[model samples]
Target: MSTGLGWRDGRAVLSAVHGRRVHEREVVPGVEVGWLLGGPRRCIGAWLEGQDERTPCPHHAVIAADGAAVQCASCQSVDRGLALARDQILDDGRTYRLYLAWFGEGLLKVGLTAEQRGTSRLLEQGALAWTFAARGALPAVRRAELTVAASGLARERFKSRVKPDHWWEHGDVDHRRALLTDARVRAHELLRGHGVELLADHPVTDHVGVFGLTDGAPDVYRAVEALADGAVLAGRLRPPIGRHLLLDQPDDGTPLLLDTRLLTGWTLAPAAGRPSAGLALSERVRPAEPDTQEALF
Candidate 1:
């Protein structure tokens, strides 16, 4: 069985695959979210939202550990062909909204989503704060995204690997909101020439609290950059950031971050207990270097 993590409606969900069948479970806070990896990474299979529920790969494809995509060649064509594409030209007449999502300081990006989805996209991307810039047909709203991206008002893409370093900023939400506000203002100004209907009076929505970051980041924590077979991850899960799970074990004083992307391609078994080996973790968060320590000290 292959089990993976995902976000739905501002909550964490665990989906498992056995043969061709898929099952889902909601992962709530204060619950010990535990799982043991079965073996090397394999293709998690295809996810075709509008067409069908996810299905196992007909070939049961095996993939590399650090590949850019979790799906194999066949699944990519069928699932990612046009879904969530900004370059596609479609006149299906669905309204779209352009938004600015702040991941951290200097990590703002421009994107568009269906008007009906509201802030779902922002929630799924682990945005700290977000705001809408405009609304219109798909093409027009996408154009707004490109305009802002080209103007350097916001990024067109972001890297997830750097997110954990700033995970401690929950207590400093005022700074996050300020960063989003400035980026949104620049984005709005950049899109003034576009034909889309500009949005106004919409305050930047903050998710630090929603992410269980209101209590502030822990003084120190560990992170998992990748996963291996037999790794055990068990702890009280905080609100996950997209697919990122922050597992805390107060008893041992070790907090860990495991990116669920690594969970995508492998089967997961419930661990009987915290194995002595447990999960391999990266370095701990170090305190800020004492202001570069001048010669006079």
Candidate 2:
């Protein structure tokens, strides 16, 4: 197979990485060349593809879903692709996106809320962004929605200047670290107040709960994946619980930290002295029950 970075609309961004000459060609959706450089190793890559209607360069100005342009070679493309990539680029024109994940039950619900209130609540409850599920379990803010417009002509320009990394670190997006820490401290205080001992500084898997729920929740899965990645990047997490868990995997598997904390709302009082085995996607967990407290986030 010829090598290249393929955008969603079936166009290939051609370049020579090492001995490989990259060019675009057809591949299945949700799969692309993983990497183009180094050993005969390859990968199928996917990216946000869209267009830019107000492109200053006339070549890129007329946006179409599948057409490729010659002008502004670096960014020459359709309207939707530009729109998709616009959110990921920094003011310096470098493109990147924040990867985050969150663990815990109700992670998806916490991610959907628009108000910062959800974030503050999580921190106050002593939650930790310890796993991808936990990190991703937080919320995502739309790039376009966060930008402030100065004037009609300057609006797109303003958006173009916003950096993804900056937004991640200082933008309106709420990761809820402080709230989670507070929650942890409070949980600790409560534990101490009641003379309960924390069994382990960090608990390992004693129960396995398989969630096939991702069958219909791609967006939430992506956020959770990113959150997991961010936690790994931040030195807050490790890998699967043990070697047997690792050896049973497919060779190409990408396992991430799954935060059982997301199961925080599972049960306030342990089940027969331990957390219950979470149900599959079929039996959804609720935040409140007759005996369980509502989730912090």
Candidate 3:
């Protein structure tokens, strides 16, 4: 709750806004992560970024957390009006790179990111294995993304709530690699005359070590209950996958999964001496699919 900013560099850096300025802190694995839900969730405020300078919300408005977004209406307008990834604006004069990300078996999806961000976007999205496809202006890259999705080479969307179940491999690495490589190859062929610069063949980048998908992962885990005021979460955390936080409950050794979206706008307090984190753990069941209108991060 100390920061209202989103994750940067995958799970390592947690960005925040304080004193009307943005600050970033590194999040290391095995670190004790503790916080109390002190107050009702507030709007995270608006980040109105223009071409030359970034702007914060002047209103500093607040709202309830029952809705999907943690932003006020004014802030959302700015985000939806210009955010390139939202597919509202095109040709913002920014270079973009297309990528194919594999979440699980048959969960490969095509997406694009600004070239400057490199692989952090993939890490943020918790892609188990991924590779770059092409680089070009936003319009071209976006076109390729849609084309791939349309051709059934790879879809444009996947239910992220199901990603944790795919972090660990069902069997061997070769199978996953083959799947990703095959998609990348077919996608490249489809995009041959699309006017984007095709990237050379590269090995699929696996995130097992950074995401702790091997020894540190749980064969089965419990999902944390809904967010409400006064809820306290305390644990040792592994490197987060996208917005998902994997926690080790020190007292009971329960492996808990917290979807950060549940806590994005909640104000939190230090829970240093709390004997136990009074969490209502739930049996792991697949969550309902997200709304089709929801924008991809």
Candidate 4:
């Protein structure tokens, strides 16, 4: 069945920073909230301060200048529908998104998912090995904040399409992918907040083609090599709608692609660079073993 909440009456715009701080408060009448993601940090739910944690629900629905709609699991999905509906502006001068990033330490491969409720999954083959955007760490530090805009009536535009998967399913993966083509392209067409960067690009091909190029079936190095090659050949990089890839270059021009295709873990360093605390060459790492197998990190 479809789950949803009714809109509050005459509520003002809600904004939260993206950081470790939990923004808990009541947004509109008849609606009580515990926390919202502020700054560039992921939107972590306010737990009882330490038990087995859970995602937070700010509101059943958001009513911005543009209009109103149900809150999906992630901001990225909801924002896709929003962008097609109307212009929305959050209090912090930003709208919403599915921010993603990648880190490395060696051969470990990983992936992550986020939204208004915080990280959904961080996997070593979709097997929740660890938190994607853990409370603190690498991917979190360099995470790229990406989003789409929408508001009141605008959100309604795509509600039906996004309702099925709830927030777990990206409202419009393909459409959102296209929007990421130019983060600023739809800004003029909608109302949103600041700090919005141009949408990064990812290949139009499937995950297998994009992530299957390296020794590991789903390693980020393969994804990175593919991305860098794609960027070099096509003159740009395109990140999958809900995924992230990190690429680094050594001073001498050696390139390393940090593989986060599994747990949003690891960093990419150049081949000739010294092995620091969290350093390892993509080539030196094994094909499909946990990075922890070696002292790569």
- Among all candidates shown, the one with the greatest TM-score: 1
Candidate 4 lDDT over 179-228, as tens digits, reads 33333233323323332332334232222222222222222222222111
List ranges where model 3 is wrong by over 4 Å: 1-11, 51-55, 66-68, 80-82, 168-170, 275-280, 285-297
**Number of backbone-clashing residue pairs for each candidate, in the order shown:** 1, 46, 0, 44
Q: Candidate 3 residues 29-131, lDDT tens each?
A: 8888678876666666554555333344567565665444667777777863336657878787889899998887778889998887778778877777889
Instruction: For residue 146, give model 3's deviation from the true position in Å.
Output: 0.9
**Which structure is stronger by TM-score: 3 or 4?**
3
lDDT of 2 at 219: 18
Q: Per-prediction TM-score, please?
A: 0.87, 0.18, 0.85, 0.19
Whole-model lDDT, candidate 3?
0.72
| Residue 15 displacement (Å), model 4 | 32
Tens digit per residue, CA lDDT, model 1, 1-297: 554676667666778777767788887777876777767687766667554567677777888765546777787666643455735446557899888888776677888888877677788778878888889998788778888898877887788886666666543767776777777777778878788998866788888888877765677777776677777767887777777777887577678877777777877777755742445577666457566558666
lDDT: which is higher, 2 or 4? Answer: 4
Error of 3 at 27 (Å): 1.7
Better of 3 and 4 by lDDT: 3
Total clashes for model 3: 0
lDDT of 2 by residue, 55-113 (tens): 23322222221112222343333333343445433332222211122233223111211
